[model samples]
Target: MNEQEKSDGIKRVIPARYNRLMTDPLLREIVSGLDGVAEALAAKQQANVLFDELGTPPPDYAREAAGFIGSGKVDKDWIGRVAKDELAKLVRAEQRKHVSDLINGCLTQLDSIAEYSVDDVLAELDTRLQELVQPLYAAGEKLTGVDTPTDAIRRGLTEEWRLFADAAIEYAKIRAAQKIAVSVAPEEFKDRGQSAACEDPHANSSVIANIAEVWESWNTPPQAELAWSDNDEGDRVARWVRPRVEAPWPVQTDEFLLWCIRNDAELRVPDLGQM
Candidate 1:
């Protein structure tokens, strides 16, 4: 199939698989729980629920206390202070439990998808995972009194998703390489025969080595920038090299570059300059 067809196929298959995976019981439960938590926070119902759980004082006792205070003409400041302190304790306890449950549920859901192979399905899964957890993190931050709980949840979610993103990118490179390798025949190059004497024997080797060096230093894929310059012979040639940024290298450095040159016309390699 042509390149467009291959891309289209991947797009279609990925979403289908993503939908199927979301149907899994564990994932659905986590998603539902997160949604419920978000709704509760949005509607400002958590405080109301907490108040209900604290329960009302008996009517007879409240009436008798009010009468006694009225008869004594005593100041109500001490009673108000005590009630405020008690309410604070109850609010904190309830919020902590709520946030803890949401975080635990998210982590559990992530564990279920931890074994998924890095493919198109993973790309979608990572996106959905982020969507499911981020709002919950926000809710946690809003509900919890201290930053520690929310910070811990954010770190946990980020670390887990990062692993999936890394694996997905690596898998994509492998699949792209396999596709290009199959499309281009080795025999096609064989007929071109030996290199011309005037051509730089070390051109491809030097370029390949430089590319490898860049890859080795990278912590992520470099955003390769393309530029063109005239050689001494006055012929304009293309060069697509990594941007001078601190990031990781792409997987299979040499193969990925070669595949780009072969498959992407715009990224075709230009004649090499003298080393």
Candidate 2:
């Protein structure tokens, strides 16, 4: 792709302005805090559900109470313990409201973020996405430097590393769907632009194949004819690298992927013009 085309591709995945916005510390803090709030709320809900099921007393207490009423047998201590348990459960139930309030606080924070520019949130998203791919990008750079480039070894090694980058890029996009409101799709190779000729020293057949596989895996299903590679080639490579999402809130998958691809492209191939 030409510089403009490459840039456009990057923008399509992650708009430059928005990608920058993601880096804002304030935005990231809000997202992290909100996710924590959500988790606390979920915990409270679990406790409430348990309280509702267990009721005012444990089963043993209820049975004893029944026996006392039926057979003139009374155990005050058992009743007291049951009452204590029931009170404990009620306290937990009451705490559920507190959880609800905390969640509301998070929603309020999210609403506050809504007032901010799309660019800022997007920038944060981009940063997180880059984090996800960093391990693979570093690995790819490292391996490319260390490996002896034979046709077989070249394909096996480089492509495998690239796959890590690709998978990380793809999965980040998929994950972004839950955070942002926008719809973003992973970029695909609709048509092969150029074949890596046998004489091309820089091109590895494995890399080329995995590139196609990367595109296909995003678009296709696990049961579909095209899926992630599972060969000795596949085993040596990871399907996806983890990208850190700045925001805890889930975003639209496509936009997330776009940002990830744009951010990761340079790392994967330094020569943007040629890529």
Candidate 3:
């Protein structure tokens, strides 16, 4: 795909302004801070869910908490870690489906990015990088040490990492665009997109997908897929990397803000003289 076509693909997935935010330093920082805010706010909003669990205790918690107390580290360190751990699980449970769908959607896009005429995207790609990559324009620069995206990508292979499998840059305008379609509305995919978990909360676990749904959840690059993830459940699970949304509040917040800045930016009317 040529540059103009590449640019068009990005426009379909997100607003052009999001691209600017990713490149520009100041706006990027502000977006990062807002992501932090989102995580804290989501936690505050869901705090009651955690407290509600107090009436019932898990066997592990009973043992751990008791051990914690006996160990003499009973101050803020003990209770704080326990509480934080529990909260992380809660967030993961609610967001698992969200994360899954993001994976499915991005994969669907990646599947046929070349033929994607306001309809297609890339095929099975890096999870977090996939989220940022429809263009994979930014990260490739230093890794390949080439100026243009095409050359850098071609060079990326000779290096250590593995992201691009030579997907077309565009069939339309050429520019960087988000690969993962999280904030994107599903209708945009014309039903070719993966179904979000929310739409079918009770899906059968035994359906036996003839094609295996990936464990990576499309969160990490291929080389990093070997990494483990907790699903924010605090237990190590298979071939997936931890998602940004499930990170500690500060980190989660930064990621969300950056995503918003890129995909769903609002008009930032400056305070100007009023400030």
Best candidate, TM-score-wise? Answer: 2
* Residue 179 miss distance in model 1 (angstroms): 18
* Sort by lDDT, top down from the best: 2, 1, 3
In terms of lDDT, model 2 sits at 0.39
Give the true-structure RMSD of model 1: 25.3
Q: What is the C-alpha local distance difference test score of each model?
A: 0.37, 0.39, 0.32
Candidate 1, residues 178-267: lDDT per residue as tens digits?
222222222333213212221322223222324334333323435678889999999999999765442232244332332323322121
| Rank ordering of all candidates by TM-score, starting from the highest | 2, 1, 3
The ten-residue window of minimal lDDT in model 2 covers: 266-275
Candidate 2 TM-score to native: 0.26
Whole-model alpha-carbon lDDT for candidate 3 = 0.32
**Model 1 misplaced stretches (Cα beyond 4 Å):** 1-76, 117-275
* TM-scores of the candidates in the order shown: 0.21, 0.26, 0.18
Tell me the RMSD of model 2 versus the true structure. 19.0
Candidate RMSDs in order: 25.3, 19.0, 25.8
Task: Give lDDT tens digits, candidate 3, residues 131-237.
Answer: 53444444343443333335444875433123332322221111122222222323433223222221221111111121023222322322334565686769987
